[model samples]
Target: MATRPASDTQVLAGRPFPLGAHPEAGGVRFAVTSAVADAVEVCLIADDGSERRIELTERTFGVWHGLVPGVTPGQRYGYRVHGPYDPSRGLRCNPAKLLVDPYAYRVTGRLTNLHAAQGFVGDPARGPASTVDSLGSVPLSVVMSPGGPDTGAKPEVPFEESVIYEVHVKGFTEQHPFIPEALRGTYLGLAHPVSIEHLARLGVTTVELMPVHAFADEPSLIRAGRHNYWGYSPLGYFAPHPRYASEPGREVEEFRTMVAALHAANIEVIVDVVFNHTCEGGPDGPTLSLRGLDAPAYYLHTKRGHMADITGCGNTLDAGSPTVVRLVTDSLRYWTQELGVDGFRFDLASTLGRPRGGMFDRDSTMLTAITTDPVLSGCKLIAEPWDATGEGYRVGDFGAQWAEWNGRYRDTVRDFWRGVTGVRDLAFRLSGSSDLYDHNLRRPWQSVNFVTAHDGFTLRDLVSYNDKHNEDNGEDNRDGTNDNRSWNHGVEGETEDAAVLALRTRQARNLLATLLLSTGTPMLTAGDEMWRTQGGNNNAYCLDDETSWLDWTPSAASEPMLAFTRRLVRIRAESPALRQPEFFEGRTTVTGKPDLVWFRPDGEEFDEADWFDEDRRSLCLWIDGSNSQARNREGALVTDHSWLLVLHAGDEPLDVVLPSREYGETYKPTLDTSTADGTPAHPGVLEPKGRITVEARSLLLLRAPRDIVEGPQTP
Candidate 1:
């Protein structure tokens, strides 16, 4: 390799103490672990563009290390190492290519044009498929300043106590009335007092911001002049996407400010982290970060040197490698320790558990490390426990420390409200899908209940569209999921009929009631309370237009949805019976009756056959408030303020029975979704079973006698 001026100023001071680049007592120490490199060179470039080279004199345990005394922060540097060019052995080190600091906190330059973006495709000039060495065309690495102290403290709320509101940073407050026009789509907007106040009002304990890390537009979208609105394609893990951060501070600093502000408001900040793969993509993709750093080391690959395409993004990360695992762990720690993020909701977390035989390892090193790491121990770790890979769906398999996004809950609730008979599927969902997650002593909160999330249709769209309409997404409407399990409510798309609109509105209420009122840690997709929509696009991941933004000026149909959501949340907060941490034990310890009573419209206890009957829709669940798993602030066991939840499916009203509480408490009407304020219009004494009319596609909450207790009723 020729010694260019870019490689000629600083001498390599080999120090093998810290693995990756780190700030030592005096200056930064850069180290990279490579098992086969014959020699490692550190090229330091000065501010004036002068460069010096130093060959590392030492190699310890396959790790090349160097500590430059005067190499301060912001110093431009790159590494050149001599190793075999055997592709079969997975060694592709080319001394001519300047490699990036695997642990760089910040980068200063652009891709030395697009060729540098090729990363290590052999030769980009020959295309990504060529086998020739493409070292000269890739970009060089630069040293970055170290992150300062952590900006905020963790809110430290328990998983059961958390009310996560997932939002797209750009879409969330962009159309809000109070946010400034300039700051509407940026991080500052999320941390703005107006945004915080709204969360406070909604009783949100955490804000799960979707993909704030730097990301790139998918090539297909870029070709169509569209962009990935969901921001799942991560380009930089350490830096917040500059576009989301508006002014003076760097991406990390801007993110810290947002977290600090949220913490100040007593709300925690959770980031949706995409670590399954990088924006570099598949064989025909960009090679900006990991691919350029060390393709085989940073990514999972077949024996043929081809990257494994499991994440559906072109490649899957090699979590089995120690270096790769360290990279992921370090990135997580950096976000939690330096950026003050309260937690992470891992995107496609199953990829992180990939073991030796391509099967997911429940006890993978990365999973164990995270669950045991002190810094991350207190942080809320959520997992979207599946991926496109065949063996990657481990939904209920994650251990006690991890909370999973219960896709089953979402599907079951949607199906039940859509009147897809045999609600027995819903029985498990309403109780946290214990069949999937009950092996451990995990509570119901372990199932993070959600009806609709960012990846799919909004609450409004779910009941308004039977199919996705993503024509504007520039993919010929072929990009999104075909099976949305949604209903168009007597019409396929938008409708003018008042009755149809009313049904759609009521159906949205049903979904919300099922989610918020069910036992679990509920997560509301932001703007669902106001019935946000993506036109009819179920997958708006690539649409940056009005299709993706949350328009605060809601439609007429949205008002009722919003009111219903507020009422549902308030009721959940008011009733300890609804938010019980543990699963119902069936028999009540106090009354000796079932802790939960399921009834049909005829006031009969649900039979084994009724549960399996797919055509049976309407059902009532009577909750014994005295059996609540919570206590007041004084720590006394909560007493029965009994509540009856009546649910009806289909398009006609039905008379449902409210079973009498074993304590002889009477039923009083409290909240009715069929009404405006969500308050019931009438109250009546409890018979052996009291009957109430339930509107089609509606959920009603009926309270029991509050204070007056009844003496034992004679049979």
Candidate 2:
């Protein structure tokens, strides 16, 4: 419903301030920063596909500016700048191609393939019917309307106080029966009260939406009618994918509304951003915005113009270059300053850390700018930590300001639960991977722990598949990792065997327990609590159908998992001990006992043999709960309290000796995971026995009387 500006406009010398686009007295002032361009033309395309090119006369600070008097919000436009075609010095400007406004708040055009628009070396016959090199000159304008500019809303939830739920926007609610058919798989569907209420009930503070930006369906997948369901191949950074919005050109407003709605419910939004590379592949790939505009500058290249393939995508973005950094920084600022998003989860974050030598530099200018930038200071910044490049698999290497997806936590927890158990691995992760994160004085929360995410198998599928069933992904089964380390519980995929189902559900609970109980910040994949599965398709980055959606109606197992998750979150929120910002010291300041004491079922400290023995599956953990930074959520300090956690890595039952609590307190049986009904096995106190039997592949938590101890004392 946006209107176009008048045909003829004066070339008024616009102010060069406010770099990208902003509201002016008459309409919207358009500006783009490019030091090399001889001239920049803003092309306004009408509904009838007619174009009016307006030259921006005012230029300053490597920026071209012009005020279009009548161009209102939602107007479709693009730019074409005249510049040198020399590729050797990293300049390849093709004025024939219509370029996307790097700052455009909303996009209105439909993506169509054109053969000439691709690199000349590729098979020209593989493109769409219209073989013209130019993608119709249309300027996608950025403007301010009734709402004025964005409010730069920030939820400002700290890592310790945050619980992330990673989900796909479309797959999350696509098959949700409560959501209307038309709205399903759209932003509106995700924003529905049912969706928000469910997340709220689960007590997750943030929703890490997987790639809501405009993305392309890989050509091979398109031929097979399957697509990139995760939307990692970004087509536009500033604009939300049009399909997620209710209608074309409404994506901005829709996304803003979704943020607002979630904010009202006290949940923040974190986008899974893929700036490591673009949809435009290698030398023979499609010529999208950056590639068509200036190939070498925007993308990393070899001496002979071949694309650098660090990202495992056909090409890697030249984050080392200023223009590429500017684009990334500008896009980040736009999402925070203009679109009002809470934060971003960088996909393959190593790409952003890439320096000239293809090595990671913590002091990289881009990382420095983003962490210190005023606009992004209050927003959450998380990284996936590793990429396909292999050089930059920096888990704890990122500076202290950022939180990293603890991939080690994921792998270890999976391996332990799948019967490859060990006590050392469990102890390290439970105390928040001190070996990985503590070297730089970083807190436990710096490690964002999770058992599964959108990129891998769901909690259900993890216990149900030994290998990836990604055949439907059109990449054969070879697309996903072969090192899943998952177990199928003696039955692959779905099963009618009630015993196997029971085992899988228990494993799911064990995984969830491990994730939440870990000292680091916990992140749960959305629908994991409800036992959602992608049919064992670990790499469901493609497949937007029911495979990714959250089935609202939970089965018996899903219901139990959901309730358990809610209870676990409540327990975590109520107890300050579980959410420490600092690393746990082995010895307590108030008491002489180790703050975290490890024990074998034989009530003895772990030996070197125990640490290395792969068979060392059964172990007990004693946390000096009195060392909790503060009281519970009710502000009541349960003084001198202690808890012993027993973890049996396999399906064998073993006796766990409860370590004596400080100050003569007695042990109270709080929860046991072996029950098939998902409820506590014993409501009353167990006989004050030194040893308790714990089932295999189960977790047991025992609470000590709070009043017995006045200060820490050696057991």
Return the TM-score for each candidate structure: 0.90, 0.91
Q: Which residues of candidate 1, in runs, are more than 4 Å off? A: 1-8, 12-14, 17-26, 36-58, 69-90, 94-100, 107-116, 119-150, 631-640, 661-664, 681-688, 705-715
Assess candidate 1 and give its lDDT: 0.74
> After aligning candidate 2 to the native by TM-score, how far in Å is the CA of 555 from where it should be?
1.8
Positional deviation of residue 79's Cα in model 1 after best superposition, in angstroms: 4.9
lDDT at position 431, candidate 1: 70
Candidate with maximal lDDT: 2
> Per-residue lDDT for 401-506 in model 1, tens only?
8899998888888888877756787888887687887777677888999999988788888988888888887668987778788999889877899888877877
Q: Write the per-residue lDDT of candidate 2 for residues 1-715, one digit (tens) a residue.
A: 2224644578677787665566677677888777778888887777676777888978887778988787776566777767765444445566666777666666554445534454343332232222344545222443535353343345677678789999888877787888888778878788899889899998999999889877776555655666677788877777788778766556777787788778878888899899888876665555556765566657887775566788888778877888777788878887876667889999999878885437898778778878888887667899888888678798889877888999999888888887776667778898889999997657889899998888788888999988889987777588888888899999889999998988888888888877877788999988888888889998877776777777888677777788888988876765556676668776464556766777788877777888888877777777776666443334344444566777787667888765544422577776667775346665566544466778777887777656443333333
Residue 278 lDDT, candidate 1, scale 0-100: 78
lDDT measured at residue 665 in model 1 versus the true structure, 0 to 100:
59
